[model samples]
Target chain A: MDFTAILGAWIAVGLTLFILSFLYRDNPLFKIAENLYIGIAIGYIFSITIYNVWIPKIYQPVSNRVFTSLSNWVPWVSKFVTPAGDAGSLTPLFPAIIGISLLTRIFPKISWISRYGFAFIVGYGAGLAIPATVATMFIAQIEGTIQPVFKLASGGAIDLSGPALWTSFSAILLCLGVIVTLFYFFFSLEHGKISKKVTKIGIYFLMVYFGAAFGTTVMGRFALLYGRFFDLYTYRTSGYYHATPILILLVLIFFFVYFGKSRKTSP
Target chain B: MKNGKIAAAVLAAIFFASVSGASAEKKKIEIPPLEGLTARDMPYDMGAAALLEWKIRDCDNQDMTYRIFVSSLAGTGPALRSFTEAGWIKVDEFKGNERLAKDIELPFWAWNASKNIHAVKVSLDNFFGKIQDGSVYYFKVMTLRGKQISESPVVPGAVKGNWFNLSRFNNLFYVILISMAFFWAVTHAKKGNLFIRRITGLDAVEEAIGRATEMGKPVYYLTGRLGMGSMSTIAATFILGEISKRIATYDTQLKVPHTEPVTMTVCQEIVKQAYSEAGRQDAYREDINFYVTDDQFAYTAAVDGMMTREKPAACFYMGYYYAESLLLTEIGSHTGAIQIAGTDAEHQLPFFFITCDYTLIGEELYAAGAYLSKDPVLVGTLRGQDIGKVFAMAVILLGAIGLTLAHVRGWDGLTRVIGNLFNSF
Candidate 1:
C-alpha cells in the first residue's frame, strides 16, 4: 500500500478511539481531539470558500479574460493597469468594488458603504427564494390535497363507484382540515369561536405530525449509532488489531489525568 | 485394590458409551443444490432498485457467504473480461476490501456492458471456494471439497436492465435546504446581535418550582438518554441552578436521576454551585444526582418507578426522548404531579402536548437557558438563529417566484440563471 493509504487508515483509527474516550469519561484527550476537529473543519471551510467562491467569482475573471481583453484593445491602458488586468477588465471591477465596500464595514468612518453590499445580496436572495417557497410548500401541498381519490373500475376515467367516492370524500375532508387549521394561525385579531375551534383541532393534527417527526429524528440518531458500531465491528473482526490502539490511548489518558492532578497539587 | 479396579472399569464403559452415542446422533443425507435464481423489480419506492432472492442449497449454513456475479449473454469469458476492465468505474469497489456475507444488492450500473445480458453467477466461498456463478462455470460446490477446474465456464439465460437513477433534482433540493440553514445560522452568529427567541414553556418553570415549594414536596428532574447532545441537560443545568436557589430558601428537596455518568458529574457540580451561591451549601446532597443505566428502556423504566414511589410534586422531562416519552409522561400524569416537558424531538411533542402542562418545541429548547440566564453569548447566538430563519424564509420565497416566472414564460435560460443564483448561496 502507498504511504497515503496507510496514513489515512491510521488517522481514521485514531479518531475513532479519540471519540470513544467519552465511554470512559470526558477528559483532556477528548477535549484536544474535539478542538482539533473544530480547527480542521474551520480550515476546510475557509479553503473551500476561497477555491470555490473567491477565486472563480472574483480573482480569475478579472486577472485573465477581462484584463487581457481590455489591454489588447487599449494598449495604453496597460501602462496604467496592474499586471492582473485582462480583457473587459472593467467588468470584473464591479464585483471588486462591491467587495471593497463590504470590507469597509470594518472601518468606522466608511461603514455606511457596507450597507450597499448587504442590500444587494439580501435583495437577490429574497427575490429568488420567495416564489419557490410558495410554489413548492404552499401550492404543491394544496394541489396534493385536492387530488382525486376515485378512479374508474374500467380503467377509463373517474368512476363514482363506492370505493372511489369514499376515497374522494376523505380527500376533501383532509384538504378542508388543513386549510381551516392554517386559517387558525392568521393573527389579525382574536379569532372568532369557529376559527378558534378549528385551530384547536388543527393543533391536534400538528401534534400527531410532530410525533411522527420525532420518531424519524430518533431513527436518524440510531442510524448514526449503528453506523459507528458497524465501523468498530468491521475493523475489529477484519484483523486490523483495533484493540491495541484503544488500550494504549486509555493508558495515556489515565497518565495525563494523573499528572495534571499532581501538578495542580504540587504548585 | 478391587474397589479401585471396579471404579476404573465403570468410568471407561461410560466414556465409550457416550462417544458411541454422539456418533450415532450425527446424520448424513444428500443435500440439494441451489435452484430457481431470479431477479425482479423492487416496487413502491424508488425505481432504481431491484430485488434478488434465491433458494439456498440444502447444505447452506445460516452464516454462509454468497458472491453474486453478473455476465452478458455474449459469453462468460467476455463478461468476466468486461467486469475486470471496468473495475475503475465501479462506485463500491471498496466494499470488497473486507469480507461480506449473504445476499448482495448490485447496482444497475455495474452491468453497463451489454444492455441485454445472459446468465448470473453466484459462488459460495467457504467450502472449496464453490464457484456457483454459472451453473456450468466448470466449478461445483460440495460440502468441503472440490476438484481442479478442467472444463470451460458455463453460459446461461437472458436478463434485461431494470434500473434508473432516481430524482436527482429532489436530492439537490435537500442538500440546498440543509446548507442554507447551516449557512444562515453561521452568518447570523458572526453578527453581534442577540437573536429573539420565543419559549412559552420556560415562562412556567418558576411557577412550577414555586408550586412544589408551597406543597412541601420535591421537584424531580430526569435528563434523557442522549449524554452530551441532551439539550435537556443544558436546560436542566440552567433551570436547576435557578430552582436550587429556591429549594435552598424553601428547604425543599430536589432529586435528579441521570443515565450518563458524565452528566451525573456535571449535575453535581451545578447543584453545588447553585447552593453555594444561595448560602445553603450545607443543605446540598451530592447523592441526589446519581448514575442509573446506559440502557435506554431500562433507565426510563427505573425513572418511572422512582416517580411513582417518590411522588414528587413536580417532574421535569427535558432533553431528547424516544419510545419512552409516552411511558414517562403517562406515569408522571398518573402520579397527579405537575409535568413540564421540553424537547426538540418533534415526534414526542404530541405526547407532551397532551400530557404535560407545558411543552417546548424545536429551537425553543435551545432558547430555554438563554431565557433563564440572559447570558449575552447565549442571547446573541439565539438572535443569530432567528436571523437565519428569516434569511432562509426569504431565500425560499424568492427562489419560488423566480422559478415560477421562468416556467410560465417558457424561459429556459432564465430558469437556468435563477437556479444558478440560488445555488451560489
Candidate 2:
C-alpha cells in the first residue's frame, strides 16, 4: 500500500473509533468526532447550496440573459452599465434591481414590494401542486380503498370473474366505516350514541392497521441496522491492516469516557 | 460598393418573401397513415410497468387521435365470474357519457381473466363503442377534423410479464436480519445479561406522572398526526401503553388528544386495553382519547385551546411532530406543566432538547418501546441494532483511514479498492 492509502485507512479507523466511544461513554474523542461531523456537514451543505441554488437559479441565468441583453441593446450607457466604471455597464443592473427589491423586505416602510415576488412564487407553486394533489392523493386513495377484494375458488383454476359479492360488500363497508369514523371527530356535531358506536368501530380498524404499520416500521429499523453491521464485518474482514491499532484506540477512548464519568459523579 | 449593398438587400427581401409564401402553401398537406405501432419496456422503473408507444403515418397533427383497447388474452368476456371458475356473471356496471382516453394502463387486475385473448385493438371513435370479448382486436388511430376521419396503422397488444424478482432478494435479507436479531436476543436473555438500557427519558416518566398526581391535575399525552408509517408513532404508542398502566395504578387522570381520527380511535383502544390489563378498566375514559381536527395549524389551535382550558400538570409530546412542536411545547411550558418529549424527527430534536425536561434522540425513540415492554421480539431487534451500530462504526473508521492514506500517498489502487467496496452493496 502507498503512504497516502495507509494514511486514509488510518484516519477512517480513527474517526470510527472516536464515534463509537459514545457507546461506552461520551468523552473528548467522541466530542471531537461529533464536532467534525457537524462542521463537515454544514460546509457541504453551504457549498451545495451555492453551486446548485445560488449559481444556477440566481447568478448564471440573470447574468447570461438579462445582463447580456442590456449590454447589447444599450451599450455606452455609463450610468446603467454593469461591473461599474465601464462604459457598457448595464450588465449588473438586473441583479441590482432584484437586490433592491429584496432589501425592501428588511425595511418595514418598504416591505410591500417584497410581496410582489412572494405572490408570484406562492401562486405558481400552488397552481402546479393543487391539481397534482387532487389527482394523486385524493382520487388515488379513494380508488384504492374502493377496489373490491377477490378470492380463488377451491378448484384452483384461475377464476376470471370480478370480485365476489362479499368482497364488494366489504369494500363498501370499509368506505363507510372510514367516513363515519371521520364524521365522529367532526366538532360541529355534539357526541351522540350513533356517532359514539361508529367511532368505536373505527377504533377497532385503526388498531389492526396500526399494528400492521408498527410491524413494518420495526422491519425498516432492523434493515437499517443490519445494513450497518454488514458494512463493519465486511471492512474488518478485508484485512487492510493488523487492526490492532484501531482496537487499542477504541479501548483508550472508552477508558477516557468511563473514567471521566466516574470522576464527575464521585462524592 | 453602394450598388453591391443595394443588390444584396433586394435579394434578401426576395428570399424572405418566397420562403414565407412556400410555408403558407404547405398548409394543405395530407397526413400519412400510422404504422409499426408497438409497446415495450420503459427504460427506467420498468418493473410491473411497460410503455406502449406507437407511430402514426399521418403527418398532420390535426388528424392524430388514438383510442386504446384492452381485452383478456384468454378471450374472456367482461363478465364477472367466481375467482375459481370462469363463467360470465353479471354484477354492477356504470356507463359514462363521455369516451375515456385511448392510451391507458391496464393494471394486473384487468388481465388473468381468460388465456384466449390474441391481441388488443385500438380504434378511433368520436363516441365510445362496446367492446366484444373472445376476439383478437387491433387498435386503429385516426385523425378527426369536422366529419373527416384519417385512419392510422393498427397495432396489437402484448402479454404482460413479471417486471422483476425484487421480492426474492427482499425476503432473503428479511430472513437473515430477523434470525440474527432473534438469536442474539435469545442468547443474551438466556445468559441473564440484565441488559441495562440507557434511557434517561423513560426513567423520568414516573417523575413526570407523579408530579401531575401531586398537583391534582390530569396528565395530557399526545401522539402527533403522523400516519402509521412513522416509527415515532409506534414508539409513542408502546410507551403510552406502559404509561397508561402506570397512571391506572396511581388512579391519576390521563388525557390523550389525537389529531388524525384513525389515530385517535387507535389511541382510545390502546389506552382501554392498557387500563384493562392493569385491572382498572373502570378508570378508563373514552372521551379522554378524543379526536380533534386533521388540519395542521387548526389542530394545533384546538390543542392549544384544550391545553389552556384543561391545564394538565404534565404533558408528554411523542411521535412525529412538525413546526407545531415549538407551539405545543411553549404553550405547555406556559401552563407550568412538566414536559417530556421524544421524537425521531431530526429537525425537531433541537426544540425538544431545549424545551422539554427530557428528550429522546434518533434511535433512542425506537429503544423506548423495547425498554419499557421488555418484549422479547423488540429487545431482540434492539440488540441486533446495537450490533449494527458497532458494525457501522468499524466501517466508518476503516473507510476513513483508507481514504486518508490514498489521498496522502497517491495510492490510485487503494482509492479504487475503497470506491469498489463502497459501491459493492
Q: Give the candidate number with the greatest lDDT.
A: 2
The candidate that wins on DockQ is: 1
- Interface C-alpha RMSD after superposing true interface residues, each candidate, one decimal: 13.4, 24.7
Per-residue lDDT of model 1, residues A131-187, tens digit only: 454345433443344433344456544567887789767765665566554543332
| Model 1 steric clash total | 40
| True-vs-predicted CA distance for residue B110, candidate 2, Å | 28
Q: Write the per-residue lDDT of candidate 2 for residues B1-425, one digit (tens) a residue.
A: 99999999999999998897676545423434444555443222222332334432323343333344332222343543232343222211112111222223232222222222212222311122432222233333434443444544434433233454332332234346545865876677655544544577888889988988888899999887685445567678778898998899888999887766445645666798999999999998878787655556556655665676678899999888877887688778878889989886656766676678887765677677777777666666666665543443344445555654564555656655454333311
TM-score, predicted candidate 1 vs. hidden true structure: 0.39
lDDT of 1 by residue, B1-425 (tens): 99999999999999998887665433222223345445443322233222333344444443333344333222444444544442212111111112221223232222222222212223223222322222222221122212211112332332223344231233245446655654655465556544443456777777878888888888988776665434455565666676677677777789888866556655666788888988998899877787655656556655666676677888888877777887788878887888988786667777788789988765566567767766555665554444444444444445555554555555665655444333311
* Worst window of 10 by summed lDDT in candidate 2 chain B: B89-98
Q: What share of the true interface contacts does candidate 1 keep?
A: 0.06
